[model samples]
Target: MLEDQANDPAIVDQVLEKSGLSRDDLTSATYSAQKEALFVRFACDVLADATFAARAGLQFKSSSSLTAYISKYSRDLKQVLENASRFHGLIDPALMFSLRVAGNFAAIEAEWKDASYARYHRRTEFLLFAGLARLRDLTQSNFFPIEIRFQHEVGSSRNKYQRLAGFPVLFGAERVEIVLALSSLDLPVPTYDPKLREHLLEYGDRVIAEKRQPKQKLRAQVEGLITRSLPGAIIQSEDAAANLGLSARTFARRLKEEGTSYREIVEDLRCDLAQTFITNGMPLSEIAFSLGYADQPAFSTAFKRWTGQAPSAFRSRLDVSAKA
Candidate 1:
């Protein structure tokens, strides 16, 4: 991470405030280092732009890591949308940077699945409303027009939509998107500084290029292996590497070059699977079997270790908390 505290002070402040954490929370030497990963995950969860998170110095092992972070931090779909709204001002800039980065990254496909594409559209809607709200407060502009581009067929929480954004909402158009006039994008942020903006943009470009380099082949391979290993599929690191057309030693070497390891990737995938299953109310035994655990007891032990609670207890707590 860059040691220069002056590069993007506004962004740094925003990240700290949104995360409810301070710089010392990240840098305190006596703190358990493992907690840092959780903080990084929190940062990723609230930031609409992945590139912006990277520029803020949160290192991720894969795109799945980002998804997992969002899933864990967001208790429900509404919470996810709310956080997306809070970070709306940063989304446009972040998306612009992401587009540049995605163009350079060979592994990222140009097309998005319907579910994935809808997520971005919804996020953009939240952003537009939040941006307009900010502008309204700043300039007392009551005439700002807000338009959303998702169709009624695209299912979302209608109650929340009506409650949070009271604007002219349109659905089912030529595009699954939201549009804001350039005037909205150009609204002056009270904290904005030209030099800091330039620095962040440059830093974002650099980080994107670094992530796109061929040296991160192991990172890509691990992501592919995790994606391929569906429920009931047993995957070994050596086998995964072989499937990637590389020897185990070569894969390890490449991962080292990318500043991560096979074990880290495996652990990340397991955590992701566990969370998804828990959230979806899949049976513990079934989840264990799906992840290739030998038996229920073994799976329970692993779950306890991972989250400090039994699967049943976790589910019970989630249910109780949801009611509260």
Candidate 2:
């Protein structure tokens, strides 16, 4: 990897010199997350554009890796994406990325775990399309998303961005994410092989069953399922477990080991989302409806449980504060 990247002028050469990493280490050694982060920062300094990451995403294929083979033959787009999210750490352990569905849309959200890679956030978000592109290739389907979004501002030319993605890009969103219609996520990948995909999934199950679950990753997987399910479907442990192909009892036990519960995670996400909508001045009823509440009264009851204040009162205080 280092040999291939060594001659790339878009990345600072000295970073490799100072990194104590040689081409040999790329073959024989593992680097820490911080080392990986340093390389990205160095790239930010030397690279003229952020789309490099996005462009790199198009290079994905059913490579020699078992994961890629799993991805290549996946039965559906959901399996391809779920497996991608599961093994994405192979790209960079310092990055946290998820493909989540909610309401009428889905989003592929990403962020650097280290604050130091903050400058690379936009590039990371743009890579969503690249992932989409690879998915299109793997499935041999032309699946264009409804919209693309990023938290950071875009300095790249609009025409160029459109050309690369063949889609519109929107910036300055709440999170570094790319948006897609929920329908897009369900489309079958054209090249899907049921037998290979099923065999891989089953083999995956046996492999994981033989090992101890990694708490942080298991939490992120559950969180992704919950995030996708919220504002539309009611989140239940059974449902999340099903999504993960795990038994409900196993899911609950794992979550307990991770020092959290399904209810707690749901409440945390709801409170955060409620606050965001409230700050944006959305009506209580509308917020309630969007948050999957049947009626304002039930939502208000839940809001008070989440925030110790009725949603109306909370909005009223915000209104007063804004005026003052």
Candidate 3:
């Protein structure tokens, strides 16, 4: 999309050559985030066009695959945004879009989980424009937001942004946000489908779960193994290494290179899983056993270390919040 909108369309070809990347790499079904970011960076450097990313993004009338289908079947704009926020990790784990209602206004805030990625002007520009385009497409309306906020400065291109957005565009704000009237969230999607929307949401949840499993990352692989083994005996480093077809020494070395250790991985995983189990109303003893701890007291000590509170205390807090 960026390529098509480049000032000199041939610049994209030059960028591909300069970056040692073939068009096939981008068009591949398995195009990864790193590859996409590389292409964007190369294009941005070569083109030096600030508005092209936003222009290209504004042209994105539809979303990708399941996300698009899910949006198409959602009952209203509110449901569409909710589903988008819920299933966002499946599309791009680095960026998160959240919808919040405050008084008479609704704000769709875009937060970058990977802080480094947030610094990329091209990527951030594309995110905002693409989101606005998708929302307009879903509602079949050109209704504008009350205002748009961006964290990056476009310098002399600021006026062009306002003209393009058909609304006020504030730069160097706290974050990327699209502010709209609260009632606009209920704007019905023209193709709303209750039944298909339900089914698509279910499938989106499964996809999110599948994405959480191990992929190519060593850390993710180790975490996946740890999670699966949590209900039984603790998985030792040597055992995990063998399972991954690596020697214990090599496993420890690789994990260290990834900025973590096997012991840290297990501790972190258990800390997270402990809170989840406690929230689900699991008995303290059962939660301890599920996390492979020998006894509840040991688990409680570790939990306090991890979260600065006992499991019972955390559960009580959750219960109080729920009641309130």
Candidate 4:
């Protein structure tokens, strides 16, 4: 959006290069100080409009891969929010979304996990308007939020935001969030598909598992290899290190420097997948096989050691909690 709105689109690339980021880094899960600096410089230095962030935000359609997945798979606003909360790290690692219900209002609270990035009010406003734009597109509703809250003071841009939002835009609030009537969450998305939603959700989770790993980190690379090789022969440590073109001793030393080992990584990865499979109601034997365990007994023993409960007992408790 900034590129299109710029007087010279080339300037956007120039700014990105100046900030020490590449075009490819824009969609990656890793957060970069250089990327954040680019936004600050663009809005404050180049555009020189206090409301440029909000303006650019509202004009943004759901063109990113993550937003396209949400548009196609989500059943309604509630599902949209759920997917956003779960997989948002794939696109924006610095912020998180959570749904909050208070009396008659349902709020989509935007919390900044990176305080340095959050301090830029323009970036926050851009995210706010961009989110509103996407929700409006998905829900096929022109309705504005009941009110908007900002943690920052309402400078001279209050009126500009009010004009854009067509509703109350409050400033200096407890947190940054978009508030709506509780019933709004039930609005159906035109593209909802139950089966496709399930498939895409699993895909999203896998993408997240891969993307959330630091790009060049040894541990992350090992985890990715393990994940891809699952349900077949589990790749042994020496083979994994060989795949990465590292000698076994060098691999062990590097992993130890990173405060982990290949065995520990395998254990941790299986524990995570075990819980996810249990939650999804996969059969115990299937979960065991998927995690590359030789048999149900071995998987069950490992699971009990990890969670201090039998697989059957864990599934039963999950069912009970769901019923509750």
Candidate 5:
């Protein structure tokens, strides 16, 4: 996967814009930067397209990534695995990783729970494959995992999966996994640099310290909940709070501390979603229903308040502009 190197930064930036990320957010991110939510948003955009979905696994060079610095100090593959696992958590809480002793084969397992692209297993597999590519570069070895497994049906990226996994990809499993012989885990990494090992560990510590746990951010959690339910279900503050295992009062207080409220978030999201639905030519009535409005009139009033024009007028203006 690393060798194929499918890179299109423009496409990524376009998707990021649609996903409500600013230019500064993209420019500031590094391999070590905490990009948990950004990645989830990117996966959703990539997985929506069948042809470009496989390229979801393609990232910038593994050697330049923060994971590279973290694992470069390992004396052997085992230490590399340990250090990699430790630092991976700081990157994203949505992804779970574990190494299990399964007799002679050590299983490297990754799981995504209620991930943004939850139903799209291709997104999950591609992400894992991308991580594996980084591991391969870190180890600087010719070895491959004995088996690679995924829980989703094979898609267009089957051949790419085979090439990177060094084994046939298996599907219809309960979880995603990679099987490697225990001996492979004991091998020494060729790129080990003793001079920079200690310094890199110190650098890794600073990176981890600067990252905030996504779960702890109430505003982000609320936004995610609102996004996940959009064009599908009505998101009440109570329901959103319950989903986070917090009481409404507690959730409200937390959101207040973050300088926002549930009503404010819902309104912001509805306005953004309105533009997408309207631009796509969805009927105003349908757009209203999708945004969980009781009827078209209610939504229209809100739309006028949001954009200084009724939904119909706004859409008609868009049409004229397109034709002109």
Candidate 6:
């Protein structure tokens, strides 16, 4: 939700050192950037109890949106890391640093959604295995001890514990935790702002608490409407309100109380859809039409205003590269 540049080199260094890898292993790939950035953030936060960088890192330079970064790098990072265990023999500290960084990034997608406890657990497991594998490769020690705490009972997959995480897996615990060696925590990574970290934690707590309540139903309804109606269908406030069985005025008041507006929701939806359409190589005219635009010219004008490039030109560049 927070869109900022990523500039956390300490996090990068910490992951690499922890995994015993370095930067030379990543010279040929650009797709791993996002995963690398996020891995650094997550690893740093876990180890240092703060964000990877005190501020946004260098990866945030070209894109102001975190979602954009994720969209671009998620797959590439995964691909690069598919064969990570093969690099276990490298002894250079710097190379170890890079491998750790890559490993952290590779494990990120698994742990991305804290909202879903199951998803969070699954990701944590994957991250533990990946981290341990890297450690094993570096130290030549296959028997690493890892302690995992889960929010609910571990699911009934007999091999779930053994097949995924090679270490000890504990479930139905009071809190979620992954215990590795104390030395793993020794990687020198700076903490982000304490106040900001506290704020974020508090925010996460509130979100988790809210998810446990019945009021989340309303939020779900709102999200459903936003997802259902967007660029092509400019859903009017009154119309959307009517669909929800509320009077237009009442719906507007409720949205205001919730700290959002119908227009803002529409704009956000448009922005999300526009990015998807652009990435998928949809013609601007078609995209505009699909989004309920009047004509190609109108869509072209709006696309330029949104992204600083005409839709056709953007598509053309993509096409040229594809041919090349």
| Candidate number achieving the greatest TM-score relative to the actual structure | 3
Q: Model-by-model lDDT, in order?
A: 0.46, 0.63, 0.76, 0.75, 0.65, 0.44
Report the C-alpha lDDT of model 1 over 131-205, residue by residue, as the tens digit: 334334433334344454433122233333444355544543444333444334333334334464445445544
Number of the top lDDT candidate:
3
User: Quick one: ranking by lDDT, best first?
Assistant: 3, 4, 5, 2, 1, 6
TM-score of every prediction relative to native: 0.39, 0.51, 0.63, 0.59, 0.54, 0.34
Which residues of candidate 5, in runs, are more than 4 Å off?
1-16, 21-25, 30-60, 63-66, 111-123, 152-166, 202-324
Candidate 3 wrong stretches, greater than 4 Å: 1-10, 18-20, 213-324
lDDT of 5 at 315: 64
Q: Write the per-residue lDDT of candidate 4 for residues 70-188, one digit (tens) a residue.
A: 65568899888878888776666557888888898899998765433443566777788888888888888887789988865533446777887789988758888999898988988
Q: What's the residue-level lDDT of 126 in candidate 5? A: 58
Residue 39 in candidate 6, Cα distance off native in Å = 10
- If both were scored by TM-score, which would come out higher, candidate 4 or candidate 5? 4
lDDT of 1 at 141: 38
Model 1 scores worst on lDDT over the 10 consecutive residues at: 106-115
- lDDT (10s digit) by residue, model 3, range 1-324: 655555576877787766567778767656666456556655654444456667777888965678889989998888888888887767775578899899999999987654435435566777788888998999998778899898654544578788877789897588689898987898989998889988988888888877753345687777767754646587889999999999989999999999999999888878756764564356888778877888989999999999999888997876665465
User: Lowest-scoring 10 consecutive residues by lDDT in candidate 2?
Assistant: 114-123
Candidate 2 structure, TM-score to reference: 0.51
As a TM-score, model 1 comes out at: 0.39
